[model samples]
Target: MTAVMEPGMDAVETDAASSPYQGYVYAYPHKTAYRPLPDRPGLRGLWAGEPQRALSLYIHIPFCEIRCGFCNLFTRIGSPEGLTTAYLDALDRQATAVRAALDGDARFSVAAFGGGTPTYLTAAELTRLFDIAEQRMGADLRAVPLSVEASPDTATADRLAVLAERGTTRLSLGVQSFLDEEARSAVRPQKRAAVEEALGRVRAAGFPVLNIDLIYGIDGQTVASWLRSLDAALAWQPEELYLYPLYVRPLTGLGRRGAEDAGHDPAWDAQRLTLYRAGRDHLLAAGYRQVSMRMFRRTDAPDTGGGDHSCQTDGMVGLGCGARSYTSRLHYSFDYAVDARQVRGIIDDYVATTDFTRAEVGRHLTGDEPRRRHLLQSLLQADGLELAGYRQRFGSTPAEDFPAELAAFAARGWLAEGDADRLALTPEGLAHADAVGPALFSAAVRADMAAYELK
Candidate 1:
C-alpha cells in the first residue's frame, strides 16, 4: 500500500493502522475536503446538463434542544427568540431559488429532514416546512418516502401527529441508551421514563417504519449493559436499528473534556468491537438482517419502497445552512463548523444572504474520484459491489484499478472468499468498517481534509 502512495495517502494509512476507528465515512470526500469555489458556478449551469428526475431532496434543521457530549454535527444548541422563524424564512427563499434553478423538470423520488433535530420545531413550524417543500420546491411529500429524525423531548404528540399526517414513512428516534446512568455518561441527559414515553408516542403516530438509534462503548459501559440496551430497544420491535460507536471528536463535549484520543486507546477499541459483535449476533438471532455496519432491519418489517434514488449516482438538492447538495460533478454546501459560536455565525450568514443561486464552497469530483466513491459506498454495504456494474460504468474492474489496496485487504483476511461476481467484506472486515472506509480515501481528499482547520 505504501508503494502505491499518491503523495498524501501515507498519512491516512498510518492513522488507520493506529486505530480501527478513524472516522465514519457516511459520505465520501467529507465536508472538510470542500473549499471555497473561486468560480462560484451558477446553480442553473450546474444542473443544465444533469439529470433532474429521481433526485433526493434534503432539508436540514440546525437547531437542537441540547448538544450531546459525543456530538460534533453542524448545529446550534437552541433557537433564539426569532431564530426559528428567521431560519424558516431563509429556507423558503433558498427553496424557491433552487426550484427555479432546476428549470421545471425536477422531481424528488425520496426526501429526508435531518439535523440537529427536525422535530425541534413546533407543530405549526413543521407544517410550514412541509408547505415550503411542496409549494415552493414542488416536492410532493405524500408521493414519496420521507424520513425524519427526532429526539425524545421533541417527539411530542402534536409533532408526531403532524409527521404522520404529512406522510412521514419513517421516524428515527435517537435513544442512545436505555439506562439513565449510561445516558448521562454519554452526555445525552435523558431519563428512561421520557424515552419510553417518546417511543410510545412514535408508535401511536402510526408511521410505517420506526428506527431506533443506540450507542455502544460509552464510558463504564459493560457487555452486559450493552446487551440490556439492545434488548430494551428490541422491545419496541422497530423496523430498523442503527448501532453507532461512540466517537469523541475535536470540538465535541467529550473532546473539550480532553477525551479526544479515546478512539486510539487499544482497550477502548477492543471494548467497542466486543460490544458491536454482541449486538450484531443478538439482532441476527432475533430475526433481523444486517444492512450495513451500522444499520439493521427486522426481517418481517414492511418495505417503505423508496429504493428508486441511489445515493451513489443520483443528484441531491439540499436546503439549509447545514445541508449539502450533490451533483455528479460536485458536492457543495455552506461553510461548516463544530464550535457553537462558529456554527451560529454561519447560520446568521445563511439567513442574511439573498442570492442562493451559486455554489459557495464545494469539491469537484475529478479523475477516478467517481469510481472510488462508487466502490467505497457500495462495497461497504452488506450486499457489496457487483463486478459487472463496475465494468459497465467505468470500463475497468475494481481489481484492475485498485490492485494494491485489494491485495492488502485480502492478505489481512478482510475480503470475503469465493465471491467472483461481487466484491464483499468478510465478517471481521465488516467489524473494522471504520478502518476500511478511511483506507480507501483518495489522496487529494485526504490532503484537503488534513489541511482543513476545525474551527
Candidate 2:
C-alpha cells in the first residue's frame, strides 16, 4: 500500500471518495469504554522525511484523582504503587525513541501538556519530563505558547512555580461549570473557589496565558445558569476561554447511565448556541477576539484571528500513552491500557522502535484522504487552508477537489471563501461544528469500511 495519490497521480481512484482504505472510527482505545466513541478520521502517513523547525508537541499524562463521568480521556483514579512514577519513566524512554526517529536537529515551536491532568505529576516528575523534552527535541523551552492542562485541585502554587520555571506560559484550567450541582452531576468534584485560586496563582506567577475550560448544557444546566457561569469566568478574565458542549459517549459512565440528557440534543444544543452567541458578544465586548470554535483570546497573543495553525501546519510530536502525533503527511497514535500490565507493555513498545508500516498508513488515509485532511486542517483554525500553502504541500485546490461539498457548505452559510488562499468557516459553521466535524470523518470511515471488507 503506497501513499495516496495527489491530483497528479494518474492512478487516482475514480471513486476515491468512496474508497475502502479509510481510517478507524472506533473509540480511542485508552479512553473511557463507558462513553460513546467519537468519530476519529485518521491520517495517511507516519514517518515524515525529517523533523522541521516549526514542529509542535503534545504530551499526555493520563492520570486523575477522580474520573469525571463526562470525560473519555485515558485516566484512572489514583493508581497506587507509584504508577505515575512508572509512567514518567516510560515517557522519558518514549521521548528518546521519538528523538531517534526524528533523525535531525529538530526544534519544536510549541509544546502542550494535556491529559487527565498533567499537574498530577510530582514536581520531580514534571521537571524530569521537561528535561527529557529539552534534551531530546531541542524544543524552545522559552517559547511563548508553552501550555499545559491542569485541574484546579492539582494546580498548587508550587506547581505554578515549577511550570513557570520550565518556560510554561499557558495554563488551561478545567473549570467545567460553576454550578456545584452541575459539577457534581458531571462527576467533577473540583470546587469553583479552587479554580479561582489556581487561576490567581498562575497569573501571579506571571504565566502569560490562562485559559479556562468550560462546558454548557450539562445535566441540569439551564441557559440562565449557563450565563451565570460565564459571568463568573469573565470576572477572572482568563487570557483565553474554551467552551465545549458536553457530548454523550456510549463508553463513559454518562453513556452507561444514558447521560445524553446532560448536555446534548437540539434543545441543549440551542442553549449552547445561545451561550456562545452571548459569550462571544461578551468576550468581544470585553476586547477579546474569537480565534476558533471554542477559543478566544486577549489582544496580546499573535493575531491568528482564532486559528491556531502552528499545531496543524507544522505537525506535532506527542508523548505519553494514548497521545496522537501528526506530521506533514501522517498521523500516528498509540493506545495505553488502564491495567498495569498493559500499561507496561505499551510503554515498552514506546521505548522500542515503532515502524509505521505502509499498511497502517493505507488504513488511515487513502481514497478521499486529501479532502479529509484539508477539512481537518481548516477546522482546526475555523479557517480553510492557505491555497498557496495547500498547493505547495498537497498540490490541489479544495474547491476543485470537493466542489459539491464546499459549494453546499458555502450555500448553507456554514462556509465562506476568504482570499484565494484562505477558506474560513462562518459563524453558522461554528455553531454546528460538532456535527460537521463528523462529516469530515466521512472519507475516513468509508476507507475503514473498505478495510473491513478486505479483512
Candidate 3:
C-alpha cells in the first residue's frame, strides 16, 4: 500500500487512509462481517416488526458450468450426477417452509434468480424452479419483474424459451469482454462467436430489459480496447449495461499469481480510472443515462418491471443455501466459501440436511448501522440522497448525524449540495467512491469482518 502525506495527519494515519482497492462495498456491512448464529433465528422473529410489508425474493442457483479467474462470488463449479435434482428438492422444501413463515399477509412484489449462473440448470429444471415460486409461494412469476442471470455458454435456446414462457422481464448476461485476447487475459475463456450467439438468443427470448455486463482493466486492456467493448455493447442496443472494473481478491485464481502482483498497482489504478471515464463518456454520448457508478440504462428503455421496492430498506427472502435473506434487523445466509473444495464441502452439508428453515449464520445490525446504511446507499447513487426524505424517516438530516464525513467529502470537492434538499457526488467523487465507502465503515464492523474465517 502506498502512503499519502496528508496535511495535518501523521504518516501512519495517512497510510491507512490511502490504501487503494480496500474492498468493494456492494451491500452494507459486508457479508464477511456475519458470524454463525448458534441459536438460528426463526423467520418469524427475523421479520417480525419489520415495517415494510412487501418483500423481494432472491433465489440463488449456485451451479456454474465454468468458474472465472477473478470471480469471488458464492458459487461452485458443475454439480455431480443427481446433485441438481437433490438440490431442487431441498430448495422446494426450504421455499415451502419460508412461505409458511411469511404468513398470508406478507406479499412478494419483486423476484430474481441470481447466481454463478441461473441458466446452468436445464430447461426442465428451470421449469421446476419457477414452479416453486409460482405454485408453492403464490408469488406469480408472471406478475413480478423477474430477473435471471445467465452466461453465454449456458443460456441455451430451450432454457431461454422456458424463461420467456415464465414471465422473465430482464435477462442479464455476463459478457465480460468482446475481445478474445482480453477474455483469455482474464482467464474467462470465451470466444466472440459464442458471446454473439448468446446475445442473439437473449434478445430473441423477448425479455423487456436486457442487461449486458462488461469488465475493464484486464491485463493488457487499453483505452481503445475499452471503447471497442462499449461500441460492441451499444450494437446490441441493450436496455441496460453495467461496466465493472476488474478486482483481484483473495482465493481467486488470479489472486494466487504472485505476491508482488497481488494488489492494485498505482499504474493499473491510473489506467482503470482513465478507461472508466472513456467508457462513461461514450455511454453518455450514446444516449444512456448513468444509474449508479457502474450501471447505465437506455434513456427510453421500458421501466415496467420490478415495482418501486428499494433494496436498501426492503425485506428480502433468500431460498437457496448461498442466498442471503435480509430483514430490518439482520442479514443471514448459509456459511460462505470461496475455495472449490471448501465450497463443495459446504454444499454437501447443505444437501444432507433436513431442516430447510431459519438463519444459520448472520450479523445483527445496531440502531446506528441502519442510518449509516441509508446514507451509503443513497449517497452512492447519481441522483443523490434526498435530505427531506431522510429527515422524515430518521428525524435528522444526514449532514447533522454525519457532519465530519459529509464535511470531509465537501472539503475534498467530492460532494455538492443540489436542489436544496438533495446531496450528490460530483463525477470525481464517484470515481473515489471505493475510498470513501471504506472510510465510512464502522471500526467494529470492519474488525469483525476482517476477523471472520473463510471456509
Candidate 4:
C-alpha cells in the first residue's frame, strides 16, 4: 500500500533544486492562438528533401456520450443523432478531400480513431466510415494497426466485434480512476461491472492491445486511494496504461472548483506531485515501461511497446473534423467550425472539388529570417536529435549554432553525449521536455510574448 504524507506537511519541497521553474528554461507561448502565418514558397523543396511516408492517421470524432469535467476535446455535448448522421457524411467527404490532396498516396503506417469516443457511433456508422476511408485513401485498413478510443459503457461485446471486423487492433479505454468516489467526484462516474465487462469483451475479441488510461492527482485522491486504483487496474491486465497528472485549465469545471474552493489540504500543487510520484513508482514496479511522460506500456507487450504513440511526431494523417496532419510538406488541420452553417460550407467545399488548402501552412513554415525554430518534436518525446538529420534538414549543427544552450542543459544533468551523432536526453530530460523546447527557441518565444504584451 502506498503511504500518504501528513495533510499539513509538504510532500516535496518546491525549492530551486526540485521545482519545475528552475534553469534557463524557455516557455512556449500557445502555438494555437497565432493567426495563420504566410506559407513557404519552397514547401515542395522540403517535401522532396524529406520523403518520409505518412506513418499514421488521426480521425477525430468530436461527439461524446457525456462530456467529462476535465475534457478539452473539440466536441459538442448531447449532440442529436441527426447531427451525428450529418457529421459522418462530412467525415467521408473530408477524407476524400484529404486523399485528393495527397495525390493518390494512401499507404499509412498507423491510423487512430480518437475522440470524445469513436465507439459512440453505431455499428453501421462505423462500418460506413471504414469503407469510405479505405475507398478514398486506398488505405490498407487490414494491414496497419488501427486504434480506436472508447469508454467502458460503449465497448460492448457486439461493438467490440464490429470494431475487430473493421480491422481495429487497438482499443484505448478511458478508465480515469477505479475508485468510484474519485471517479464520480471528477465527473467520470464509471461502473465497476461495466469496466470489467468491456475489458473482457474487447480482450476476448482478440484486440492486439488494450490500453487503459488513468488519472491521478485529483482532489480528495490520496496515495493510498491512487494505489488501490492502480492495483485494481492491473488486475484487469491492460496491455498498456496511460497515467496523467490533472492540471486546471481555464473555463473547465474542475478549474472552477479551485484549490481555495476545495476545503482540504495545504495546497493542490503540493498534493499533485506526491500522487504523481507514487503512481509512477507503482506502475514501474508492475512491469510497465514509461513510454512518455503520461504514457506507459507493458514491457513485454508485443503490440504497444515502449515507443511514441501520439500522432503529432509519428507522421500521422488526420481525418474528420478538427483533425490535424503533419506532413513532410506542411502541417494542415481541418475544423468543422462550431456552427452548423460553417459545417455545411466545409461539406459543400469537399463535394464540389475533393481537395483544398489553407494559408496557415505558409505562415507557420516559410521565410528565413534566421528562424530560431525550436525542436518541439525532439522536446515532446525524450528521443534525442539525429545530429546528421538536423544538419541535412536545416544545414546547421546544434553544437555550432547553440553551444551555450546545449552546455546549459548538459550542466543540469539532463544531457548525455552520444558518439558524433546524437545528443541524447536522460530520463530527467524526458520529465521536463516541454520546458526545454522553449529555451531552445527562447529568442523567438520571448519576442512573440513581448509582441503579445504590446498589443
Candidate closer to the true structure by TM-score (higher is better), 3 or 4: 3
Segments in model 2 whose C-alpha atoms lie over 4 Å from true places: 1-48, 260-264, 300-309, 336-364, 417-421, 444-455
Candidate 4, residues 1-455, lDDT tens digits: the string is: 00000011111122222443112122122223234444523323333333335456677776667656665455545454477677777677666655655533435777778766788888887887788768866676787778888888888777788889888877888888877888787777677777777778888988888888887767689999999988988997788887765543323446456632332233554576567678777888989887655567788887533223333334446676556555443555543242334444543443343334332222244432222343444444545566776677678877777777677777888777655777677777655543455455444434543343211
In lDDT terms, which candidate is top? 1
Off by over 4 Å in 4: 1-31, 34-52, 258-267, 304-315, 335-363, 367-374, 402-405, 417-421, 437-455
Clashes of each: 0, 19, 0, 7
lDDT of each model, Cα atoms only?
A: 0.87, 0.61, 0.79, 0.59
Candidate 1 C-alpha lDDT tens digits along 277-396: 999999999999999888999999998897589888889999999888999999999999988999999999999989999999999999989988998989888889999988998999
C-alpha lDDT (0 to 100) for residue 369 of candidate 1: 92
Report residue 78 deviation for candidate 3 (angstroms).
1.0
Runs in model 1 lying further than 4 Å from the true structure: 1-15
Name the lDDT value of residue 361 in candidate 1: 96
2 or 4: which has the higher lDDT?
2
- For residues 209-317, write the lDDT of model 3, one tens digit per residue: 9998898889999999989988988999999998887777667667657522534477777887798889999999999998777889999999866675787778888
Per-residue CA lDDT of model 2 for 378-417, tens digit only, reads 6546554667766676677777777776666676687765
In candidate 4, how many Å is residue 237 off? Answer: 2.0
Candidates ranked by lDDT, best first? Answer: 1, 3, 2, 4
Q: What TM-score does candidate 1 get on C-alpha atoms?
A: 0.96
